[model samples]
Target: MKLSPSVTIEQSETGLEFIKVASEFCDATIFLQGAQITEFTPTGKKPLLWVSQQEDYQEGKGVRGGIPICWPWFGVSQHEGWPAHGVARTGLWRAEQVKEEENSIYISLSLPMNQIDEKYWPHKTKLLVEFILSTSLEVRLTTTNLDSETLNFTQALHTYFPTPAIEETKVDGLQGSKYIEFGEGPFEQHDLVSFARETDMVYTQAQDTQRIITPDGIIEVSRENSRSCVLWNPWIDKSKRLSNFADDEYHVMLCLEAANVLEDSVELAPGDKHTLATSLRWV
Candidate 1:
């Protein structure tokens, strides 16, 4: 496959192929399998994304962090023994196009419906994930339904960000949004969200822009075509049970995902399309 300047096809130690972007504006890595972006850092800023040190880059497995494209569905499946957070995160994607501009590199990847298990995703749909790497990281996932029947589903750009201290981290701009945590309480957010124990909150009617305040700096996160998002930190006990994640690693990472979940879930008419997008920049 031909790549443009500042882009190269690289393979993980486990032989998983990925696209590496090293331009003046940023440096990033995106695995073809799952189309997962595991790294992104602007020229003089610390990393804007985070990946687990225990994450073993291998085929048929999603990387622990960066942005995992949870598609067809989000969270647990109603079917027995299905993978949580959907199959798109573990499926391979084909690079459809790559374009480089003055300060950005855009790489578009597509997952063929045939590559997905028929039992999991029977609909005829086109899934494309596009990465715009520059001074900041921009991700856009577009879903186009080619089937004759209408489609309904939930999805998210499950993004993990890094902080020097999780205790000092607070997320602002969700003050009035509604959230359901541990599958309970459509509680209204009253103040800046702070982390102490394990935090897994699904928020709806969230504002498009949020500020993640960390000791190092603030990260400005903006969403497009999404009113719902997920905020997570495994804390202690659950961190020990998670795969591809070290127990102590939870102290420095948090996920603020842009999603279409629950009441914010997507419904597409035949031949319709929808795109979920998010942007992150260190401030």
Candidate 2:
């Protein structure tokens, strides 16, 4: 497969390109303006998570918006050879297949050996990501456990929620759930309550569905076979550091990530199938 194919790729006047991968049920629209995602009508609209242009990677800076699928590792590096974020994200995915119909477009992108450093991971596997773009954006990522043994990994759908104010915003899905604060400064004292300043938390064994209602819009997030919910939003200083993020960017973007990590890591048995899904709808 060609990393940067010479095939004819067209785009709209706004520089947005839609793709449907053949033989796979997935599709996606790439907004070239800031490489942001304006619409991911997957399954329905329940998982339209990442806020458009809320954050972006400046050549010398870091990565920003577009539903960044935090996989194998989340956030900064926890292992060797793995940069702050995984390499798969920065790499260009090859469109090996595309299936289109009048109502929806299904696209599939795979990362071959030539495009990735297999030495970091000894297993011979194919990362198959499918985007079902319609009224709602549905994304399905399948790691074909090509090797004979089980593959242990962590993953998260880092969905950024748009809001009018961080103080007024409240996430409704984990009302009574238990969580652990992972950052600095007396987290247990002031962080146990609802939305406030610079909120960052990880809720374990969360319910199947979560809702984020803000002054800007109402977002309903649902997932099948999910065990945890991670919520984060950089209110003041952190927001200013992000390249595309304005001084008041938090007023427009919130992170309500659907994740499976830490103690809840997924262990896929050999040839065994494990799938995680989330849907977002604007209300």
Give the clash count for each candidate: 0, 33
TM-score per candidate, chains pooled? 0.98, 0.76
lDDT of 1 by residue, 1-283 (tens): 3498889898888999999988889999999889999999999989999999998887888889999999989989989899888989998899999999997898999997787889998999999998988898889999999999999999999999999899999999999999999989899999999999999999988899999999999999999999799999999999999999998999999999999998788999999999999999987
lDDT of each: 0.92, 0.59
lDDT of 2 by residue, 58-115 (tens): 3322246556666556667666656554555545566656555666555566656465
- Stretches of candidate 1 above 4 Å error? none
65: Cα error in model 2, Å? 1.2
Backbone clash pairs in model 1 (N, Cα, C under 3 Å; residues 3+ apart or in different chains), count:
0
TM-score, cand. 2 vs. native: 0.76
